[model samples]
Target: MLPLWQLTVAEAAAAMDRGDMSAVDLCEAYLARIGALNDGLGAFLTVSADLARIQAAQADARRAAGERGPLLGIPYALKDLFVTAGLRTTAGSRMLADYVPPYDATVYRRLQVAGAVLLGKLNMDEFAMGSSNEFSAYGAVRNPWDRERVAGGSSGGSAAAVAAGLCAFSLGTDTGGSIRLPASFCGVTGFKPSYGRVSRYGMVAFASSLDQAGTLTRTARDAALVMGAIAGQDPLDATSADKVVEGYAAGLSGRLDGLRVGLAIPEAGDAEQAQLLTDARRILEAAGATVEDVRATADEALIVPTYVVLVTAEASANLARYDGIRYGHHVPGDDLAAMLGAGRGQGFGAEVRRRILMGTYVLASGYQDAYYGQACRVRELVRRRLEATLSPEGGLDLIVGPTTAGPAFPLGAKLTDPVAMYRNDIYTIPANLAGLPAISVPAGFSAGPAGPLPLGLQIVGRRWAEATVLRAADAFQARDDSWRRRPVMATSAASA
Candidate 1:
C-alpha cells in the first residue's frame, strides 16, 4: 500500500467513505510527515496543526452524518500568498511575516465548505516576484527529488510540499508559469484555471491582472476535484467571470476521439523540450488524439513583452498600498517618512524591489504610452491570434507543449540573472498571457544523482475550458505509468 500521506485526495476520500479510516487518523499521519520533513525542505512558512485537528474533527462528524464532497477529510496546504482567516499569510515576505488576515479568500472559504482540512501556509517568492523560490525571505524550497536543486517558483513550496507527501495537495498561484514550472520540477499535476474562473478576491496581489490561484496535486483527477470545488464567480471580485463551472471530475473520463491537439513548435523545440513534447504527443496519439504541428504566425514573440508590461503596470498600482501606514511592514519611529522609507527598503527582497522600480519607471508620465500602451495593443492582437487558432471551427481541442525549457536548476544558479531565470518560464508563460486554462502533468524525467528529476507536459485550452483541459490531462496521465511511481531516497545515505 502507498503511504497514507502519498495517497491522492480521491483515494483518501474513498477510504474515509468506506469506514476504513478516520479523518483524525489521516490528518495526524500528514501532520507527522510535515513535522519530519519540512525542516530540511523549508516548504511551509507556517503549519496550522491546531486548526487542522479541529477541521479534521468537523469532517469526521460530517462523514458520520453521511455527507461528503470531493475534498472531505483531505489535508491540504495554501500557498502563503492566499489569505487564510486568522492564519499568518506572509506570502514569503518579511514584510508580512506576522500579518494575519481577518478573513479568508473566496477559494479558501469554498474549500472549507467542501470539507478540506487546512494544514498550513506553504512558502513562496516574496510578493511572488522571482522565478525561483530563493527570493523567499524565509528560505528556499528544496526539490524533494534532489535537495541541491530548486523546486521551481513562486509556488515552489506548494509543489515541494505535495511532492514530499507533506500535504496531499496544495493551492498555488501562477502569474506567469509559477504553478506549472514547479509542478514540472516536483513531478506532480498543476492546473491554472481560466482567469476569472477561479475567484482571486483574497489572494495577495503580485500583479493583480495576471495572478491566478491554481492547484498542485498528485494527479490530474485530483486537480479536477479541487478546481470543481473552488471555481466560480464571486461578488467580491469584479473581474470574476460569471461563467458556469462544469463537473471537472466528471470530465476526467472524457473521450479523446476526434480531438485535435495542436503542437506549437516553430522550428521544433530544443532537444530537452522536444523529447518531452514527443513523448507527450505519442501518449495523445495512443489515446486517439490527432496531433498536428501548428505554425506560430510570427505573433508568438510578443507574448512575453506584452505580458510584462500589463503585469508590471498593474503591480505598480496594486502595490501602492504597502506604504507602512497600511497592513504591511512598518519601521517603528517618531518620524513617519523615515519609517515608511526604511520599512519598504528593508522589507522587500531584491527581486520585488527590482520589479517595483521597473514598474514605476514604465508607468512614469513620459514612458506609459511608449511602453505600457503599445504592450496592451499587442496583447489584444495576441489574444485574437490565440482565439482564432483554438476556435472550434479551426479544429483544436487543446494545445500541447513542454511545461518548462528544462527541469529545475541548482538553488542559487539563476539568482544572479533575472532575465535568464525568467526564460525558464517561456513555455508556460504564454498560457498566462492569454488568461487560458492550462495544466502540467509529469511527462518524463532527466537523470540525476537522486535518479532523475521530473519532466512535464502542458495542456492549454480556450477560456473557461478547464473541463476540457482537465479531461485531456487526465487522459494523458491515465495512459502513462511512469508518473505513478516515485524515487526512493535512502535515509541511510547521509548528505555531505
Candidate 2:
C-alpha cells in the first residue's frame, strides 16, 4: 500500500473503509506531510491543523455509524480564495490577509457533508490575476520537480500541494488556465469542469463568467471522485447549472472504441512535446480511439486578447468591493478619494493593480465599445465556434492538445515579460473562453537541468460533459503511468 499521505483520494477512502486506517490516522498523516514539506513548497497559506483533527474525528464517528461517503475521512485543502467559515481566507492577497469568512463556500460545504477533512488553505495568485503565480502576495509556489521552476499560476499552491504530497488533492479556481497550467507543471491531474457546472458561491469572484472551480489530484479518477462531491446545482449561485450530476467515476467504462479525439492547434513546442503528442496519439489509437487533426477556422490569436479584455473588465467590477472603507487593508487619508486610492494602492499587489488599471481603462466610456464590447463579441464567437466544433454532428468526441507550450520554466524567467507569461496560457485560454470542460493529465516528462519536468495532454469535451472528460482521461491514465510520477520533494518527505 502507498503511504497515507501519498495515496490518491479513492485509495485513501478505500483504505479507511477497510479499517486499515482511521480518518484521524489519514488526517494526521497528511498534516505531518504538510508540516514537513509546505515551508519549501509555499503550497499552503494556512494549516488548519486543529480544524483538520476535529473534522477527522467527526468523519471517523460518521464512518463508525456506517456512513459510506466517498470522501469520508479523506484529507484535502482549498485554494485560499475559497471561503471557510471562521477560517482565514486570504485569496493570496494582503487585501484579505486577516479576513475570516462568516460563511462557507458552497463547494466546501458539500465536501464537508461528504466527510472530507480540511487540511488547510492553499496559496494562489492575488485575486487570480497572474499566470506564473509570482503575483501571489504570499510568495511563489515552487515547482516540486525543480525547486527553481514555477508551479504555474493562481492555483500553483493547489497543484504544488498535491505534487509534493502535502495533501491528497486540492481545489482550485480556473479563470483562464490557473488550474490546468499548474497541474501540467506539477505533473498532476487537473480537471476544470464546464463553466457553471460547479457552483461558485462563496468563492472570491475573479471573472464571474470565466471562473470555474476544479481540482488538482494525483490521478483522473481522484479528480472524478472530487468532482462528484463538488459538482451540482446551487441555489446560492444563479450561474450554476440545473443539470443532473453523473456518476463520474462510474462513467469510466474503459471503453474507448470508436472515440474521436481531435488534435487542437498551437501545434507542438519542442521535439519533446511533439513526441509526447505522438505517444498520446498512439495510446489513444491503441485503445480503439481515433486521433485526428481538427481544422479550426476561428482565429485562435484572438482568444488571449478577448479573454484579457473580458476578464479584466469583470475583475475591475468584482474587486471594487474591496475598498478599505468597509473591510480589508485600510489606509487613512483626509479625503474620500485619497483614502480609497491609498488603501487600494497599498492593498493590491503590482499585478492586481495593473489589471485593475487595465480593466478600468477598457470599461471606460468611449473605449468600452472598442475593447470590452468587442472582446465580449469575440468571446461569443469563440464559444459558438468551439461548441460547433464539438457538436455531435461535428464528429469530435473531445479536443486534445498540450496544456502548456512546454514544461515548467524557471521562476522569474517570464516575470518581467507579461506577454510571454500570457502566451503560456494560449493553449488553455480557449476552454475557459468557451466554457468547456477540460482536463490536463500528465503526458510525460522532459529532462531539465535540475530534474524531470512534466508535460500535459489536455482533453476538452462538450460543455457540461465533465463525465466524458473524466472518462477519457481515466482511460488514458489506465494505459499509462506518467500520472504516478512523484517529485523529489514528495519522495524525500515520504522517506522522512
Candidate 3:
C-alpha cells in the first residue's frame, strides 16, 4: 500500500471515505513530509500547520455529519500568489513579503468550503516573472528529480510540492506557461483552465488578461476533482465566466473515440522532443481518435517576444500600486516622491526591476504604438489562428505538442541570458495567448547527468473545453504507468 503522503487526491479522499484514514491523520502525514523534505526542495514559503489541523478537524466533523465532496479532507497547498485571510501572500517577491490579506481569494474560499486543508503557501518567481525558479526572492525551488536542476517557474514550488508528495496537490497560477513548465520539470500533472473559467479575484496580478488559476496534481483525474471544487463564476471577479461548471472528475470516462486530435508540428529545436510529439500522436490515434499533423502558422520566433511585451506592459501597470505608501515595504524619505522611489528601489528584485523598466519603455508615449500595440496585434493574430485551426469546421478537436524543448536544465544555466530563459516558455505560451485550456502530463524521462529527468506531453483544447482536454489527458495517462515512477528524492522522502 502507498504511504499516506504519497496518495493522490482521489486516493486520499477514498481512504478517508472508507474510514481507513482521518483528515487529521492525512494533514499530519503531509506536515511530517514537508518538515522532512522542504529544506532540501525549498518548495514552500510558509507551512500553516496549526491552521491546517483546524481545517482538517472541521472536515472530519463534517464527514461525521454526512457531508461529502471530492476534496473533502484533502490536504493541499497554494502557489503563494492567492490572498488568504491572515496568511502572508508574497507572490514570491520581497516587495510584498510581509503583506497579509484581510480576505480570502475566491478560489481559496471555494476550496475551503469544499473542505480541503490548506498546508501552506508555495514559492514562485518574483511577481510571477521568470522561467526558472531562480527569480524568487525566497530562493529557487529545486527539482525533486535532480536537486541541482530547476523545477521551472513561476509556479515552481507548487509543482515541486505535488511531485515530492509534500501535499496531495497544490494550486498554481498560469501566465505564459508558469504552471505547465513547472509541472513538466517536476513530473506531475498541471492543468491551466481557460481564462475566466476560474476566478482570479484576490490573486496577485501579473498580466491581468493572461494570468489564470489552475491546479498541480499527480494525475489528471486528481486535477479534475480539484478543478470541480474551485472552478465557477464568482461575483467578486468581473472576468469570471458565467458558463455552467461541469463535474470534471465524474465525467472523466477516458474514452477518446471520435475525438479529432491535431498534432501541432512546430519547430521543435530538440530531436528527442520531436520524437515525443510523434509518440503522443501515435498513442492518441491508438485510442480511436483521428490524428493529423497541423502546421503552426504563427511564427515560432514571434511567441516569446509578443508574450514578453504584453506581460511586461501589464506587469508594469499592475505593479504601480506597490509604492510602499499603500501597504508593502516602506522606506522613509524627506518627500513623498523620494519615499516612493526609495521604497520601490529597495523592495523589488533585479528581475522585477528589469521587467518594470522594459514595460515602462514599451508603454511610453512614443513607443507604445510601436511595441505594446504591435504586440497586442500579434497576440490577436495568434489567437485567431488557433481558433480557426481548432474550430469544428477545421476538424481539429485538440492540439498536441511537447511541453518544453527538452527536460529540466541545471539551475542558473540560462539565468544570465533573459532571451534564453524566455524561450523556455515558447511551446506553452500560445495556449495562454488564445485563452484556451491546456494541460501538461508526465510524458516520460530523459537521462540526465545526475539522474533521470522528466518531460511532459502538452494537450491544448479550444476555449472552455477543459472537459475534452482532461478526457484526452486522462485517456493517455491510463494507457501507461510511466507517471507512477517517482523521482529518487521523492522516493526517499516517501520511505523516510
Compared with the true structure, all predictions reach lDDT values of 0.85, 0.89, 0.91
**For model 3, how does the per-residue alpha-carbon lDDT over 1-496 read when each residue is reduced to its tens digit?**
5888878888888888999989999999889889888999999999999999999999999998998888998999999999999999999988997998999999999998999999999999998898888999999999999999999999999999998889999999999999999999999999999999999999999999999999999999999999998899999999999999887887788778988988877654477777777778778977779988888533666788999999989999999999888788899888999999889988999889999999999999999999999999999989988999888987889999889888999998998898899889988999999999999999988999988899999999989999999999999998866679888774464535
Worst 10 residues of 2 by lDDT: 294-303
Candidate 1 TM-score versus the reference: 0.96
User: CA shift at 319, candidate 3, in angstroms?
Assistant: 0.3
Report lDDT (Cα) of residue 393, candidate 1: 75
- Residues 162-255, candidate 1: write the lDDT tens digits: 8888888999999988999999899989999988899999999988777899999989899989988899999999999999989889877745
lDDT by residue (1-496, candidate 2, tens digit) is: 7777778888888888899999998888887788788888899999999999999999999999988977998999999999999999999999998999999999999999998999999989998888788998889999989889999988999999999888888999999999999999999999999999999999999899899999999998999899999999999999999999999998987768878889764543578767877888888887778889875322447988888888889999999999997799999788999899899999999988888888999999999999999998988988888888898988888998889888999999998877777778888898998999999999999889987999998999999889888988998998989998888774464534
- TM-scores, all candidates, are 0.96, 0.98, 0.98
Show how many residue pairs clash in every candidate, following the order shown: 0, 0, 0
Residue 302 of model 3, lDDT score: 77
**Model 1 alpha-carbon drift over 4 Å, by segment:** 266-268, 296-300, 490-496
Q: Which runs in model 3 stand beyond 4 Å of their true positions?
A: 490-496
For model 1, what is the C-alpha lDDT against the true structure? 0.85
Ranking the candidates on lDDT from highest down gives 3, 2, 1
How far residue 382's Cα lies from its native spot in candidate 1, in Å, is: 1.3
